[model samples]
Every structure is written in C-alpha cells, then in structure tokens.
Target: MLLSRKAWEIDLREARKMRHSEVLGCCPHDCQDGCSWVAHVEDGKVTKVVGSKEHPFTRGVLCAKVNDYQTRTYAPDRLLHPLRRTGAKGSGEFERISWDKAIREIAFEFGNIINDWGSEALMPLHDMGSAGALQRRALMRLFHHIGASRLHGSLCGQSGNAVAAEGHPISFDPETLAESECILLWGANLLSTAHHHWHFCLEARKMRGAKIISIDPRRTRTAAKCDEHISIRPGTDAVLAAGMANVLVEEGLADFEYARSAADDLDACLEEIKAWTPDHVCEVTGVAPDDVVRIARIYGAARPGTLRVGIGPQQSRFGDVFVKSLSALAILSGHWRLPGGGLSIEGYPTFDNAAPECPELSPEGTRSLHRGQLGRILTSSDLDPPIKGLMIWGHNPLVNQIDAETVRQGLCRDDLFTVVIEQFMTDTARHADIVLPSTTQLEHFDVQGSWGHCYVGLNHPAIPPLGESKPHTEILRFLAKEMGLDEPALFADDETIARSCLPDGFDWATLNQQGWLFAPQPRRDPASMGGSLKMSMGLDGPEDLNVRDPIAIGKLRLLTVKPHYLLNSTFANMPRQAGQQGNPTLEMHPADAKSLGLQDGDRVLAQNGKGTLAAMLRVTDAVLTGTTVLEGKFWWTANEDGSPVSNRLANSNWTEGGQPTFNDIFVEVTATSGFADI
Candidate 1:
C-alpha cells in the first residue's frame, strides 16, 4: 500500500539524534472539550504531548486522560494487521491475512447478504469514537451508497439538543463565564468530565468573586468546591425549575420588565407555575423549601448569570422536559440581556454539510434504526427482514450500550456477518468475524468541532501508520474499490474532504499554522424566543412521578456515572489508566448500606429484573439516601471470578427523544462473599 508522502519512516535510533519539531493537532475522542494539542516529534518519534498555549479554550491545559496520549498510541497491544477469525466467536483467536484478501472477503460477504436478505439487512453501528469530521463521516458514504440500514440519533445528548433547539435559546461564549456574578452548575460535573471548561468557572470565582452553586443527586468533586451544593432526587429536575420560577415571581423578586421584553409568554408561564409552591416542589424533588427559595433569590439578584446544564440529567424518561424547563428558567430570569448571561447547552456548528453522514446519498426510503435499541434490533422477531450483516466502527456497543448480554448473544449467531475496525480488540471486537487495524489520531489527518467551546481545529499527521495499520478513510476506500463502487462521495480523497470541512472562510494553510479558530456564532433575538416559553408553560407535572420514584420501597436507583480515568471505554485497557481507575466500587449512603448489612469494602451484588453486577461497597454520605453510584466503562463482561459487567443491570429504555435512559434504572443490593453464582 502507498502511504501519504508526509509519513515518517525514520528509525528510533536516528530519531533520537534529530532536533524536536512541533505539530498542531486536535483531540479526536468523544469529549466536549475538543482540546488543541501540540505534538513534539523528534524526527519521527513523539517524545511528549502538551496543550496548545495559543488556543483560547485549551489555554495550555489538557485533561489527565489525554496528557498521556503517547502511551496509548504506542501501546504494546495495538492491532497492526487485518485478521480473520479461525476459532469460535468470542474466543479471541484470529489469523493474519493480507489487506487485499480482507477487503475482498468483506465485500463479497456484504454483497451476498444484500442479495439474500435485502439491503436493509446490512447495518452500521458507530459513534463519536473519532470526532474528526473526515474520519467519522468517511465510512458513512460507502454504507449510504450501498443502501445499508442507518444508525439514527446519538447514544448521548440527542434529547437535550432537541429540546434546547426548539426554544432557540441564546448561547453566549463560554469564555465569558468569568464576567458573571453568579453561576449555577445544574447536573454538570466539570472537574471530572470537562477540566478545561472547569478552568473558566474557576476564573469566575477567583477573578470576579462569582458565587457558584451545584444542584445534583450527589456531592461530586465539582460540587464539593462550590459555595453551596443542593442534593435532589433523580428525574425531578423540571419540577425544581418550576419551583424556582414560582419563588421568583410570587416573592416579587423577578424583573417583570426584562422578562416581559425577553419572552412573550411571560404571563402564561407565571400562571402555569403558580401551583408549584416551594413546599410542593420540595416534596417531589427531595430538596429543602428554603434551599429552593435561596437559590431563586440568588439567581434573581444577579445582573448576569450563567446556567451550565450537563447532559446527564437529560438521559431520563422526561429528559426533554427537563431541558425545556431549565431553558425557561433562564428566560424568566432575563439573563440573555447581558453579555455573560445565557444557556450553555451543546450546539456544534456544521462545517461542511457534505462530509459527515451524507444522508442524501442513502438509497431513498431506507429504514432507520435507533442506536439505543441495539440489543432489540439484533434480536427482534418483528422485523420483516432481519439484520444479517453489521459493520461496527469507532464504537464498542457490547460495553457501552445497555442490554449488553443480548447484543453478545446476537453476535454469537453463526449466520450474522460482523466486521470491526479498531486500534485494539475491545469487547465488541472480540465477537467480530473480521477485525481491521485502524490508525490512531497521531497518524490521521482530519478536522473536528468542539461541543464545550466553539473552536474548530485541524489535525495533522504526527507520525506514520505505526505498522500495517491504516486510516479509517483509506480502509473504506480500499473496500469501495474491491466492491466496484464508483460513487463520487465514496472516492473523495482525505485532503479534499478535510479542506472542504473547514469553517466558511478559513483555508487549510492558515488553520494549520494557527492551530484553531473560533466558530461563527448565530444571531438570536430574545424577543422572538416566545415559542420557547410557550413550550415550557405546557410542561405539566409528569404523570409517572409517583410510580417512578420508589421501585419497590427497598430498591435503589442505579447511577452508572462517568469516570475521570477513561472516556467511555477508550483508554480503559492501558496499564497506566487501568491503575488510576482501580476497581469499580458501588457507592451507597451509610443508611442504605446499614439496611442491607453491608460494610465498606465488602463484596455486594446489585440485582434487578434486567441483570446483576458485583462490586465492592463504599459507604459515604456524598450520595443520596436511596441512590447508588457505580462509575467507569467496561472492557469485558466478567472477571476470572464470574462477576458481571458494569452495564449488566442497565436496561435499553429510551427518553422521550431517542436518547438512552442509562440512569433510569433501579436495583436491590445484597451481601455476597464472591460472585460464584453469577
């Protein structure tokens, strides 16, 4: 195979004697902060990686996970060549094969599946594994041209983005948080998930003496450092927002003039929330009445404040309502009038409409499949033509998705043809009939947009494809030729795709030198945001509130939270990351632990109708009374002792939009010495 001309081909011994040179790049993982990084290469070897100091958002700082990216790129276990399965599925046995043979077999098998079971029988499962527009979208062109079933909606943030979009909420630059007088972090755990965004919040506290408040079910690392933390029940965020609005208006603290001018449905919203008294809200949300009143007063008195809403709370059954209600609270408070005041929800700018999904290229009227229901799609009996072929790239559904066991069972089918493209053998990859080695961020060329901030940065190839590994685009190009597909979108060169996706006026040369550029902001007039308030006013109390709270009076709501050591399941296999993350533990309140006769560090099994998981107990007051926390992603199903996977207890339920309801699960805890019966 002919590689890129810019590829590095020097040996390590020769690299050691050469001077160091810096190349600008962007982090191509599934992160809100698409951090700008500088790779310091000595001849051909990357000695170290650091955050780009010139970038406005990154500001010379990177998260702990990306700080040691070189270790992951050069890990000993990375896949370097294509392999074909030679043993039973999930046996992790494979024999090396030439690239030409691998592509030919995949094309041939895909053609057979299409001819036998119809085009819809072929489906592709993917996500933000590679956030680069070129890399993430390149594979879709081939699938679209072939009329394969499409993966619809995101595994995360679909509901929130949909709800936020309907209201046309004004979004201010995140860097302006330092100018605010008050900041409310609603469901956002910045210290753990978004360190760079947290840095700006810290600047508000240090430079402007801004009062910061946290509202969540647990006292997270970010909440512990805030001025005050308010613990509340799960799935009741919308009601809490309504209560705050009631206090603001009823107590005569609301700015009537500003609210009237900003939103046309001010009176309608006021009447709708009149019955949501502080006491009634406290009963539903498990928050103190006085605490709600205090937060309302603080929010009302500030001239300019920011409401940073995280996507966690939006993964519930009524997630869209939660987002709409919070957005309404910002409207009633009249925060959009000031420069630093507005909502900070995700709105990633589309650089090029042509590169990403190429939704237009798909054969007209093809069936769309929801990603949250992967298990059902693979095992369902109602479909006219069942899925016979699955192409997975940049995503590990077996560990990341709910109902993982069902997905594993589907993959074990002898008739199903599975293909996986990855750098390492993940749990999902182990079940594949064909495994293709893919290049890392250091050996790829692409461009990416940020969710935490507005910058869109360029990614330069820092080194050559490690061994026989190839970029995702090149792999698809080879397959397209083997299949005799000649669509223009399928054959677009990597450089052409990358250049086309740059922000409106920016060129490749200037962006490469500057490292990053801020995205163009859209102008939104607050007076025209009346439709948002109208939607919020119709949000009556959820009917299922009472039934949703107590699963069985003794069961606890399971919260599988994100971990600081890994991004989804990306770096979980690295030795350094594995040590930092340690063993997964079940965090429960002391009262809850005592009721189950469980002690700290004791082995316990959390069981529900869906599945069961074994983890060490951690009794702490940080979590709420009827809630338990289990953090981090999974690399495999069980340990040598037969414990179940972390997502075993999670169901494949979805929110009102198509987002997964990962946190809307309940389980009962029991003491166990070992998982021998698992």
Candidate 2:
C-alpha cells in the first residue's frame, strides 16, 4: 500500500468517507503559534487538514510550509517501518525490521552502555520537533528513568528574553497591540514568520492610525509594508536602541516619573544614554543620523507604543545588550505603563501547565550537553565516559547544529551506536544505526498549546498510527517492556499523561468540547512589574567581542536567517516547498560585491575560521555593505560531493545567555568562478 509520491490530493472516495468526521488537533512544529487545526478523516485516512477559524489568532489561515502538511504525512519517502542499517553510517542503507527486534536491539545496546560506562554514556538528544505535551516529553521521562546525561540549551538561538524581559518572557497580550499608537517591529520579519499577527498591525493603522516601523538590515517583505524601514548594521541593534533613548530623554518625551517607579538607577540609565549621541549611533549602526532622530521622535512621542522583538538579534555578538536596550526604551518613555505600549519579546511559557517532576535515575554529577554545540560535544575527547549511545529524537542535528560537517563526521564514528526516531529520512536519520518510524501529529493523541497564542488545543487521534509507526507514548512503553522495567509511569497512555500535566481542576472533557481552552490570566499593566525592568544590558564592559583589527579577521559579518519556505529543515524534503526555494544564495550589498570583484549570479565561496559554504552570489542593496545574508537549514539541497549546508557558515560559540551566536560569524567572500567586469 505505497502512496504515490506525486499525489497532492486525496481521492474522491477517501474524501467522501472522511467528510463524515473531522478530528481536532494542533500543529506541533517548533513555531510559537501552536495553531489549532482540524483533520478531516475518512476510512482511517486524513483527507485534508485546515486551521480552526474559531481559533482567535490563527484565523483559518495556515503558512505555506504547513498548508500542505497532509502531503508530508503521506510523502512517498516517509519511513513506514523500523529500519536496521546495513551499510556505513550516513550511507542511506537499511532493511526493514520487526518492531520487537528493533526494540530489543535498542534495549540491549542501551543496557550494555549503562552496564559498562554507567548511564551517563547513554545520551538522549531531543527538542521541539514534536512539541506536544505528551509527544516530545515522552522521551524525557524514559531518559530520566535511565539517568542519561542532560541536554541543557536552546536551539532557538536567542538570549533576548533573558536580557530584555527580566527573565520572564512575555508578549504584551498581542490582542491589545491594536490600541497602540506606534509599533516597532525590530529584527522580526512579521510578514513571513509572524504572519497572523501582521493582520492586527494593519488593524492598528485603520483603528488608531498607528505608525508601523520595521527595523532590519534587509528590506524584508514586512519592511516593504511598514510606514518606515530603518536599515541598521548587523550586530549593532544596541546602538540604535541607546540612541533612541538618548533622543527621547533629551527631547523631554520620556516619562521620568514612570522610570523612577519601574527602573532602578533611573538617573544612571538617563546619564548613560546622553553619551549615545546620534552621530556616535550612526557610526556604529550604519543608519543615517537624520533617520535615527526621526524614528526616535516618532516612537518616543507616541503613547502606549508597542515594541515587538524577534529572535534575529540573538544571533549577534551582543544580542543580550541589544534586546535589553530595546526593553529599556519602554520604561524610559513610560510606554510600558500604557495599554498597548508594552514590549513583546517572546510568548513562550505562557501556558501555566508544565509538570517538571521526572524520575531521577542518574547521579547528580552527570554531564550536561549543549544542544547547539553537538558537533564539539560529540568530537570532544575530555569526557569521563565517552558518549557511546546517541539517541536523537525530534531534532535534525546534521543540518541544523553549528559546525554541521563536524557533526556529520562525529555521527559517522563506528564506535557510536546511534538511534534516530523520525518520520522522514532526514540527513540526521540517514546516519543512524537504527531509524524508528514515529507517528505524525494527525495520528497522535495529545494536548497542545502555543507561545504565540493563549488557546489550548486538543489533538485527537484523527486516525490510527500511520503504517507501523506508533505514537510517542506507545513507543516508549514498548521500549520499557523490552528492557524488562515495569514503571507504571512509563506505561501511562497519552490521556493519562495529558491529564497529569493539565492545570489543577481543568476538565479534559470540557476543554475538548469547547475545542479550545483559554489561559487563565488577567490583563497586566507593565508598571505592575516594578523594578523587574532589566536595566543592566551588561554594556559596562566589551560590547563588540567579535570585532578585531580588520587586517586579521574576516571583514563581512554573516547572518543565516530562517528561510521563508522551510521550517528549520523540516519542509526542505517537500518538493513543493524545496522546489519553490531553489539553491541557497549569498546575498551581499552591490558595493561589497564590486570591491571583491564579484558579480551577481557568480559562484562565490564564503569562508571563515569556522568553515566554508559555496553559493551563487546575489548583489543587492537589501544587505548592508559589510554583511552577507543566507537563508538557512537548507538540507534537502545537496552538493555532489558531500558537504555541510547552512550550519557550515555558523560557529557554536554562544552568547552571554548560552545562546548560539549564529549571526556573530564573520566571513571572507571570494569569487570561485568567472570574475565580474570590475
């Protein structure tokens, strides 16, 4: 019963049968918007999937990447059965194996590793690939029982939340942004990433005539629609923020009384901003002094203006300072005190229900691995008991991690017994000793929520597990049985687990009946969190740690941004998404292209001390003269000779907040082929 790879639509018979019922579910991808969705199921097959129009924020619209999600579940290349590798690692060779045998092998290997090198050698790697409450966390429970090493870091690659939001990530009730007089979308491509929220921004203009400004180095689609687009230099977000504060205080637009109540050392903050003159800011941020002054005056004068922060700034050398500086402007102008004038850095941890209690089996001193530094962690020789069993679930490290070539090399090690739980045959899955098929979101039962929205979602099993794939809980249960352990917690079904994680006194039946559950939260004024405004940006010391005499270091700063079509390499395997997004090109300013004797469409090599990647050059003014842009996690697009794709350009050096400095890299560009007519 192999499905046609090219088939894009369900047959009439399947469709008619599925029309009888629609199951409620939610998209479990790594997006902040955990959009509630409806799966039209007929004859045990999902005919179609669509967003819930009833869901307030998603509003029935789905992103292009997820709109064709049914195709992904039924993709011809989907790993339908358990596979045991026969050829070399990363060779894409395997034979289908029975579930019992697969589980037995995994158990035996894991037990051997624990017996010989202690449980710490058995490393479990998991992340937000399947973000359902009972989906990804199922693996965590098992690892805790085994005492495997802990993975403590974020692949989101941003520490702005820690820097700006006073350690509590809050978005100012996105629904209230429409009342704002002005909106600043800093480093966020709202049109692409936060598409749904863009509608509210438009409404703000119609309702209140709010001025919308986009601050980015590139004139992104969102920037094009913005009333103003201010191009700032890469890694220089802090400078502009400081300069804005300077003008606000000097022009008497700032609310001194509000700052006095909310921020400690208010006078010290004001005195610091006085030195951040417009001319000094222009030199560091690459923005015209006039534009800087104009934006500051417009934003500072507006009451209850909203400030939206994105993950882009966290990729810089001083992302913490950059985000803190932006957050401070709200306090300086007393904008946080206004209804629509607060800041929304991120909306994670909005859900009040997360059960952190896990059975502690490992010793207290087990090593903790940073998820971003997988390459360096795997290749390191200083470990007490070297990582023998590497189990990757819900994350594609080969394509997404820093120094991916090194990750590839490390995965190929014969001594490492690797296991990957996945749906598609990803780059990381190809390197596994065993590939275990996992159920798609439509075929799983779980409770889900969103960081972007306040609605809770119910993911009913629209159909039975696809092919021989099992739901996450079932898989873990089978493994526990094979290992001869009968922990009642391990055998608990999805319903039981979901119920346990729900907020106290929450009724599952009622929540499902309503099709959504709204979080219990009263609207909070920003001034209520007095003295919690993160005043320190850590700017008293070295701000530009990456900057050195240009004579020795690479000149151009590198920024690998999220692709408009791909979601962290997940959709790269889809023809519709991957085909639409062709080869990865390095976009550079025309001035820099001319200086390097390069022309548009020329094959160029971008090299830094970390690694090098080759792509066709695009000479455009969309990028700053001293910086280059490359859309990332491009794994499906492969070169003839095996090489790293997107992560090749990024180094694993983290920021002050344990975030990957994906954008802090500096690269030297050279024309690999025919030169330009310089």
Candidate 3:
C-alpha cells in the first residue's frame, strides 16, 4: 500500500537508542486532564513523551497543546541558568548569575525586606507550575516558615470547589457519566479544555444513547458538537436552573422520593423557585420559554440525568449562589442517585493527601492577600504596607492575571524587587529582578495527583537538568539553608516529601511501574451532600436573577473562549502552538457586528475603560446578539503591533472567590479607524 501523502511528510528523527526504558509520570499543568504519561528514555535523554496507554481513564491520549512538551522543554529560549535583570521590566534582558550568588542575593534582599516591613512584605506567588505533589506547595513551607503574608481567594477552582464542598463530603464522580442517558454540559466546553473527560461524555451519547445539551453564550466547539446548544445570558444560570425546578414541581416530574430524603429543604427551595415561571426565566435568561419547558421535560423524564457544571459559569458575582441553585435543581429532579447521573463539581480522590500543604508556615494574624487582586495589591495605595518584594513560580501573571496594565505597572515598580522561578522567559518572568531557571516536569522527582481523574502517579527525573536549573523544591531547600532556617520540613528531598504524602502500605513502586494508582472513587450518593442541599436558601428566581447594570446597560456582555489549541497562556510561546492559534479574532453575532457598523475581518476596539483590546471581527451568529466572544488565553507576549490582545480589555475585577472575573462583563465594540492584519 502506498504511504499516505500526509504521513510521508511527517518529520522523522533518528536518535541513537543506547537503552530504552519506559518511565511513568503525571502532567503538571493546571488543566483538567491529569494524564499518566510515558517517557521513552534512551541514553539519559527522553526521545518521546506520550500518554500512558495503561492509564484507564485518560486512555493514553494527550491534548494537542501538551503532546510536544518534550520539544518545549528543549526550546532555544528555555531558561537554563539563574539570571539578573539588566534591562527595563518586560524587556527580556538578563545576565547569567551563579546559583550561590543568586540564592544569597535573593535571601539577603528578602531578609532586608522582612526586616524593614516584616515578613508580610515578602510575598510568594506560586501555583501548580510543576504541580508535582512534592513541588506544588514546596514554597509555601519557606514562606510560611518566614511568616510571609498569606495569599487567599478563589484564584483556582476555589469558587466552584467551595460551593460544592459546603454540600458534599466527597466530589461527584465523573466516571458515572457513562451511565447517563441524558447529559447536560453546563457552561463547560469539554472538547477543548477537558478533552480526556470528553471520552466518557461520548460514551453517554454513542453507547448509552444520551442526548447532550450545551448552554453557553457562544458556539463553543463542545456546544457546536452537542445535540442541542442554547444561548443563555451571562450570570443568569441560576434563573434557568430555578425555572427548571419550577417546571419539575409544577408538572409533578420531580423525583419526590429522592427529594424527600436527600434534600429535606426541598419545600423551602421550591417555595422560592415557585416564582420563576418559564416566561420570567426567558425574560431573565436569553433562553426561550419553550426551550426551558423542553429541557425540563427531557431532564425530568430521565430516570436521573447528570449535570456536569463547568467552572466557566462560576466566575460571576453570584457564582456561588448559582452553584447552590444548580445543586437544588439536580436533587429536585433526582439526578444524584444514578451512577453516571449527578452534579459533577471540581474534585478528585485522595491518596495520602496529594495536595501541597504547609499549614505550619502560616503565621497567625498575617494579612491575607487575594491572588486574583495581585494588580490591586501592587498598584493600590490603600494597602497598609505595599508589597515590597515578590517571588513568582509556575504561574504567568502578565497574561493570566486581570488588569494587565496594572500588573505591568506594578512589575515596573523600581522598588518592587521581584524574583521569578520559571522554565522559560514568560511574559511575567521578563518583569523580574532576578529570574531563576526551573526544571520541567521531565527533570523533576516528585509525586502528583490528578484533579480531573482518579490517578496518583510519580514524576521521576527523565533527564538531568539542562543547565544550572533546579526543581522548585530544591530551590526552596537551598534558600532555606541560606536563610539559616532549621525547619526539617523545609529541606526535605522529593522522595522524602513524596513518601510523606502517602498513607501506610501504599505501593510506592506502582506509581512508576504502571504509571498510576487509582484512588477511591467518588460515591454515587454520599451523606455529606445533605448539608449543602439542606442549608441552601430558596432558589433564586427571575426577580433575584436580575443583574442591575454593572455600570452600563447597552454594551454587549463579553466572554472569553479558549482557543481549541491554546488552553491557556502556558504553550503560547511555543512556536508550533502559536502557529496553530494563528491571529486572535473576536466573534460577534451578525446583528451586533452590523450594529457597530462592522463586517467580517474588520478591526474593532473592545474596551471596558479599565483596559482596551483590539481584534478582527468574525461576524457570525454563533454568539448572542448582545454579546461578543473573545478567544483566549491570548499570547500577550507574542503580540505584534496592532495584533489583538484580549486580556488588555478585561476589567480586572475580583469575584467573591478572589478569582479574576474573566467573564461577567460588558464592553462596547466599536469599529477601528483603520484595519490591520493580525
């Protein structure tokens, strides 16, 4: 058979294989897919990194963004040594510095900052950069040991996780979705952001014959591929859920038996939901009256349908309350009893407490800083003692954080001595006073657990450090020694730390042998759910759902849609990832585009006063007529002159959880004076 032309063009490599060994490790990115990956190592170098075919849930497939991470780790721009900044912030200029010198200088500066303004002045900004169980929270111990200021707020999945935790003892198991006869992907674009879970969703469709319904303002890939897509108004999720409850109770379709026991406060919840008629729901949510009845009928008709709520809808003012209302609606419809039927919140099982914890490091009475408000914390004069020094890890603030301009200004502060531990010269790293080279997951030895799937795995060193780079844990240990910290926990090696995180009799070798060990899966119905369902106030109906003008009324509500390839800003700097993303474009309904006197490909200015971003217009009716869609997370660092920058237009406001309200805003999109190709 002739080789396919496409296959023939594939670039082939012929690395000399001295000895090949399969090594297992887990992904360290802050993505929903927790992949148990396999590294094919030969001669102390990794030849290939692919998903572990043995991983039951992930089924050995990696997303487009992460599949080529081996190349990214070895990219020419990859940081290999510690460096001191030699140019203006964001200028990306640095001079190499020895590890000892860098550590000593950073420690000295940190001590001075602490001596002058107390430990609270020295802030550490870290996230799941390596997400290695050993590395994830390693810096916290150092910061806590030093009595640094505490960082608080729902920056990660905290907002959604908080609401779910209040009601459930354990997280709802997503694996049960395969048993679902009808699946509603609420606000989640699973195909793009959570690809691994999409497989089970497909089983619900092709195998179980489940009807899939997607509700969002834009025509996301997941929505476009689903059986039905509904365009709902932003922040009106509670209204739709409450309306569904009204219909379920009015038509006697609610699971009365399940509601009576599982949700004792059902009557009180119904009392509030009784006011939300289909018409009222339509008036508040952009969903039509008939669509509401149709969804309610389909959902109620199922023995117990499943509701998998996405984090996308939980970044608004009433995000927490919306979760509560959605929970009530699920119980009212008896959706929690089936294996694959229930509300799947953000959660993963535990194996010796996989999350990073250094609670002892938190000093009593320390001021708490919200991670999302980094901009405000840095720029606001009202701060009692402004942040004098900053240490960043894993996360890229210049692109991920809101108020891009504020972050830029804050990082530019001559007085703010910032140190960033990074694998590359990220947009955020460029703003640092001293940039420390950090190892990729391939060069780290640590334990890691998945928040998406039930798998606890280990990340063994697949290769030696490329340069003078070190793991976050090692760096923290070095700093602890430099600062004369006697805390034993502060200097634990990866093996010791990883071992401490597991329980007795845990098979340490299974992590590397099979690549993963399954944790105790979530129960179909747990008693802990009662507390949340019982304590929830009556559902918020149309009257309660009405959002007053958030400063103005006529402008279209804005939403950011993550491009299929670039899940976030992580791979934006990678050449291949950037090429796949192409130019940034803002999708608008044809009517909205016409209202702004713009056409397809026309450049438009989308500004909310706090920031101004520009993008080419894609005039399609895929989005709501009164809303615009900006695809993100944009490569702000790779932006060319006149290129679209989505974050520049974000309002930079904080949600109740302290996470940036990336959505939940309104903006005026006006035609630009001249068109420029992005």
Best by TM-score: 1
**lDDT on C-alpha atoms for all candidate structures:** 0.81, 0.77, 0.76
Tens digits of per-residue lDDT, candidate 2, 432-457, equal 99999998987888877666656677
The CA lDDT at 661 in model 1 is: 80
TM-score of 3: 0.92
The residue-level lDDT of candidate 1 at 312 comes to 83
Model 3 poorest ten-residue lDDT run: 542-551
At residue 221, give the lDDT of candidate 3. Answer: 85
For residues 1-678, write the lDDT of model 1, one tens digit per residue: 765545544454456556667888999888878899999898688878899998888889888888978887899999999999999999999999989999999999999998998888999888878888777777888888889887677777877667655655635567878878889999888888887877778888898788899999989999998999999888888889999989988877666776676666777778888888998888788899999999999887887878887878887777777877777787777777776676777635546635555788898889999876888898989976899999898899888787788888888889899999999998888899999998988998888876667788889989999989998889878999999988877778887777766655676567777878777566353556554345344567764633236534778888877788888887878888777877768899998888888899998888988777877789999998888988787577435555446566777788767778878878899988898777
Ranking by TM-score: 1, 3, 2
Among these predicted structures, which one has the highest lDDT?
1
Total clashing residue pairs per candidate?
Answer: 0, 3, 5
lDDT tens per residue, model 3, 268-324 = 776788778999888888689999999998888876688877877777666766777
Worst 10 residues of 1 by lDDT: 543-552
